[model samples]
Target: MMRRPGLALKLSVLLMLGVVGAMVVDFSLTSGTDMDRARVLVFVSIALAMALLAAVVLDTLIIRPLVRLSAQARRMEDRGYAEPFVPTGLDEPRELGEALEHLRQRVLAEREELQRLNAELERRVEERSLALAAAQRALVEGERLVAVGRLGAGVAHEVNNPAGVILGRAGLLLDDAATPEAAEDLRVIMRQAERIREITGALLRLGRPSRGERGAVDLAAVARSAMELARHEAVARGVTLELSCQASEVDADAAALEQVAYNLIRNAVQASQEGGVVRLHVAGSTLSVSDTGSGIAPEAIPHLFEPFFTTKKLGEGTGLGLAVAHGIVRDHGGTLTAENLPERGARFVVRLG
Candidate 1:
């Protein structure tokens, strides 16, 4: 590609061409003049002066201002908009420089405003995240205390009956020593103590935080067992039990999974009305227990997973079943949620990851 000449070079070339044309015209017009040589000398001097003047004019008006503007642009690119463009020269170049300066200031202002907005956005996000985390922690702690209170009450009630039996039998034995009835009394005492031990053991197991003895557990089998356990309760309530499950496996404790399934199924059965149906559906690692009965109260949905927040009658439920099931599923890296069905009744879904 042919390189384009700069302004200065092009102007100088035009000046030289004009001078040569003038010399040719003068020589042609004064071809017969006796003072031709002097005339040529005068013409040469004037041409040289004009050329020098043109060079000065071009340098001052065009060349210098453009060079300055280019340097200012480079500096702005390298060091940012700290230095402002100072207009110089007369006429067009100066006007152009002023326009560039105005544009630069506007851009800088917009950039600063953008940075401020970005900082504000980040601050708001962080604040919301912290607040959300704190709220979640408080909610979890509150639920935990409620669970403890319910467990304590249930334990006390369960232990009280067995304790009374043991104490009464011991008193009878003391009153009738060496009697044939004393042996039977001793045996009854032992049986009541064992019952108390079993109740405590169950509580301990439910309260345990860790998922016990992980293995590849067949979810279909667990669902079957849970259904079988709840079958009697469903029958007693005149409710039908329906199961739809595909064979699926998960890394979990078989006993823990069984407990979760049983608790959920039993709750569904209890929630159902006479002649209603409780359906258990399992697909992959997800299980849903749904019942055709009155849907859950909207207000109670939020506290459904909380301990001692049951809607059942006082004697019918201790309110710890769902809480225990929730904890067990959580320990196994899963989630359990309850939601009222669209048409009627409620559904409990468990998803294991």
Candidate 2:
């Protein structure tokens, strides 16, 4: 920007021009006489000089402060705000300076307010997105529970018949307790038979909606414990079960988290081709399961976690593994996402924060 002329320079230029003009006019009006010319020059010079002096004083006292105030305003407009100069010993300029400073402060406050509003807007957008995603997941889980209830009804009816026979026969054996050896073996069998009942009961609980309170739990520990239970299946399938974990905790049920890990690992093992690697890696606060098998089709990625949605052969899978896994993660305040790996496989990333 062009620098404004200083008051001293402006006043000096104005005064010089005025004097020169007066000299010219005076010479033009005077008669062609040396004495008259000298006298006219003196009078004109004096009058012009006094007028120039007055102009200088006014500029120093009035015009300069006005210019400084203008510069202060422009600076505030361009740079948001800054400390302003206060005019001393003058009512008008002091008042004007205070007004300009107030204006600058107001503009600065408004600018800050605008920034705050923008940040708030972004936060709300993120919250809405998370809520929408959570609601959609909830809907999918509700549908899965409904299907599980139906399947459990059928499975219960089928399995309960045999369970009743096994329980009845074990009770009869226990009643005998004739030989020490026979009783020990019978008791062992009876206990194992009773365990099957417990498992079926647990499955029934899972098929129904859960009523557990939220609480803090350790995800890494839960995952490791679940692995101990599911290791046999991975071994049977000739797939390696590997876990890379970190110290991580979350607000969730320990049992539900175990179920989630169980479902995820079982699915990973099943998804792998024979002799494939099923890696369970937990980093920071997220758990990931990856398998070396044919990746899920792009079309199926979106529906993989839905109940009864399966990519396996007709009888190979019940398809409730991923659906149940999804529910478990949601109930624990987390997320489950599946994607096709870059090379040739599927990876599921579960985040708990």
Candidate 3:
């Protein structure tokens, strides 16, 4: 490839041409005159002055400003736009410097703003990720509870006929007992068999859809009846049941609602410590049972409404209470949810729409 001549080389060539032309003119004009020395001096002086002027102009207009601008560009590349460009030299160079300065400032401002926006975007992403994780956990728990309820329903169905037969025979034996002790023993067998029937009934309720008739039902009255039904259990457990709200009505099956409230209140009483209180709250379209006992176990919360998933000791509970209650509420076009209280115990809320 051919190399181009630099500015300094071009200037030097022009100066040499000027000197040669001046020498030729002097030789021709002063060859017949005694002013040859004067002509030579004049030519030399003019060439020297032209060379000096060219050097000064090149240095002032191009070389010095170019060096400064290069240094400024290097500083910006190495350390970023920490300082503004200071213009020097001719108008063109000064305007170029100003333009560069403006661009640097704008770029720096945009970069900072972009950083801020990136930080905000990251925060939002983290929040959404946490929410998604929580939702996934809830969905998994719901699926597991459904699976358990289906299994429990099948087992309960298989055991129902045998339990009914035992209960029937025990009732017959109690009536024909030869002695008082035999009658008492037979009575005990019948009572135990009745408890089994109750459990199987709850399981059937959980597994099947409600066929109860719907009517305008007063929730407060239902709550009262539920409280009365649970009164004996509460007294046995030494727990107090309290009603804390006025009348509320909904278009639902009164028996279903009553059963739901009875199950919830009974479970609360059973979970409570002796002398603890279970409060029943009935507001417009909502009923809640809050118990003053140790809150539910964190690991058990997911399975709380599942049939046969009980935190109570074996033989003390059949675990179908909340499952049946949940089904009943759902059949009434309502929602039932349970949560642990912050300070103590647990709360079950039913919303009728």
- Maximum-lDDT candidate: 3
Candidate 2 residue lDDT tens string, 1-353: 96343211112335422432222331343335677767766876676677677677656666667678878777765775766556632467767877877777787799899999999999999999999998987676667666775577467556766876887897898788789888888888877667556545544544652456667766678778888888999889998888888887677777877777888888878878888998888776688888887788788876787666788887566566776677667655677888888988888888875
- Clashes in model 3: which pairs? none
CA-lDDT, candidates in order: 0.76, 0.72, 0.80
Off by over 4 Å in 3: 1-158, 179-181
Clashes of each: 0, 0, 0
Question: At residue 127, what lDDT does model 1 achieve?
Answer: 99
* Per-residue alpha-carbon lDDT of candidate 1 for residues 61-134, written as tens digits (9 for 90 to 100): 76688779988898887799978888888788899899989988999999999999999999999999998996
Best-to-worst order by TM-score is 3, 1, 2
Better of 1 and 3 by TM-score: 3
Q: What are the TM-scores, per candidate, against the unseen true structure? A: 0.51, 0.49, 0.60
TM-score of 1: 0.51
Candidate 1 lDDT trough over 10 residues, lowest sum: 16-25
Q: Which candidate number has the best TM-score?
A: 3
lDDT score, candidate 2, position 173:
82
> Taking the tens digit of each residue's C-alpha lDDT, what string does model 3 give over 92-193?
887887788888889999999999999999999999999899778756755665566567668779988999999999888878899999999988888888
